[model samples]
Target chain A: GESVGLHLPTLSVQEGDNSIINCAYSNSASDYFIWYKQESGKGPQFIIDIRSNMDKRQGQRVTVLLNKTVKHLSLQIAATQPGDSAVYFCAEKGANLSNNDMRFGAGTRLTVKP
Target chain B: DAGITQSPRYKITETGRQVTLMCHQTWSHSYMFWYRQDLGHGLRLIYYSAAADITDKGEVSDGYVVSRSKTENFPLTLESATRSQTSVYFCASKWQMNTEAFFGQGTRLTVV
Candidate 1:
């Protein structure tokens, strides 16, 4: 069995502070990982992604870090804002058999306080 | 350009009735996936299709059926809807593995 999980269920931060969301995956064979931001009543939106070959990838205001040796993935949001508040989920894609499938983490709720 | 679209954004069906959720993608992606989102379960994959006429079950596929007659469409049907089948269903499409997937708004199904 494979599992992907987050370090915390919820995170609260100030409007101007930085926020870090951590995810630990159990499958070492997973070669690709993605971070999604989901707002209430909406579908998950693509944020950033990192491959096992790379350690970090940066986007508009978000960065994804991957530590393959430790099977850990993290999403860093710089200067948190009210718009950044959402449930963040990490997903890993792997070749389960002949086909490919993606497994999603439990999700970490990010709440930014004004 | 519409990336992906789903029908019946909100649905309410009976427990024993049959319900089908439609998913369509305009990018002509080869891969399409159906997932249900629950409070504690996160997003669980129910089924996925690699191409037209080719489909496979995912982590949670029981009580559900899927068909990909065309590459642009993937539909998920609940043979007999149950209270447990009530959840927000999402459809996603990716050009290939390790690529970014575009998701539809999602269908909220409530079984009574």
Candidate 2:
């Protein structure tokens, strides 16, 4: 069965510190991965994404790292801010190119302390 | 106005009532998806369409129906709404499977 899951359900970090969220995927055929952030009462927003061919991809304030060997994915946020406090989800898509093949993981709730 | 959008951002329906949620995207994305977001369960795929007139069931599509007659529109219907089906529904679109998906402001559907 193909599934994506997070390593932690909650994380607390001090503002201006860094935060790391982790996810594990079971499908070896998954070739693309994405990280999304969801604020309260809002839909999840795309944060970053990486292809299986690449180990890492950097965005403005976030970076996505892919470890294909362990089927693990991680999102790193630098200088965590209050705006960064939200539930973050990791999604994966297989090589089949079917939208049905995309899957999302239980999110990690990030709390940033002032 | 240039991205995906979902209609009736909030809805309250009684059980056994049929409700349809509308989704429209301006990008004409090749892939469209419907997902239900519940506490602890994250976002579970309900249905998806690869293109116009091409639809497929997703992990949690049993209680829902979807149709994509136009490339820019995909609508999900709940023939008989259930209490368990009360969850925030999100519509997303992507130009390709390998690209990042853009989600519309979710529609908070509550089945009373």
Candidate 3:
């Protein structure tokens, strides 16, 4: 789901369940995308990344999927844990834009319930 | 140790006063960026530098200023602090265009 006004889109899931976060980007030419996990009062931590050429990329218990035609990106977390509760963001950079100028999407808050 | 560092993790200032947030990175990355995170808005870029002294404005750069005089430091300054400027600030750097950016702990600013 997406955000509503000042309220962030929230996803509440049970522990040990799988979590899927989706983001729709605007730039079709974007060749780079990244997913960040940010806990309260802390900076964003890079979780995973995907390039335009790749449909999917995986990390420790996490995966990133990119659909260039639809300009969509998603993050999948396996075996969700309480420690995994945080705000997740998706960033994109087009081929014409520098990677350092990555643009971020409205974050989605993931809450893991015991 | 070998990452980006932001000074004065928390700051409080008057609305009309000027405030500066400091960012330093040990990685010697070629690019540095400043972004503000608001409640509804995710992270929005304020300014960025391709290298030392090559700063450029991002999508939401109004009422703010940034200078990159050295490769290791990039400072963001609010000429006159406003209530709307109060938010968490993050500094990030990337060594190359294809790499992921590393973020600092962040600085929370409050304007009274």
Per-model TM-score of chain B: 0.98, 0.98, 0.97
B2-68 per-residue lDDT for model 3 (tens digits): 8999998999999999999999999999999999999878898999999999999897899999988
In TM-score terms, candidate 3 sits at: 0.93
TM-scores of all models? 0.96, 0.95, 0.93
- Candidate 2 iRMSD, 1 decimal: 1.4
Q: What is the DockQ of each candidate?
A: 0.78, 0.73, 0.79
Off by over 4 Å in 3: A1-8, A95-99
TM-score of chain A of each: 0.95, 0.95, 0.89
User: Which pairs, if any, clash in model 1?
Assistant: none
The DockQ for candidate 3, computed on C-alphas, is 0.79
Cα lDDT tens digits for candidate 1, B1-112: 5789998999999999999999999898999999999998889989989899999988899999999999999999999999999999999999987887888999999999
Candidate 1: residue B27 lDDT (0-100): 90
lDDT of model 1 at position A17: 98
Q: List pairs with backbone clashes in candidate 2.
A: none
The TM-score, computed over Cα atoms with residue i paired to residue i, of candidate 1 is 0.96
TM-score of chain A of 2: 0.95
Sort by DockQ, best first: what order? 3, 1, 2
The alpha-carbon RMSD values of the candidates against the true structure, listed in the order shown, are 1.2, 1.5, 2.9
Pairs in steric clash, model 3 = none
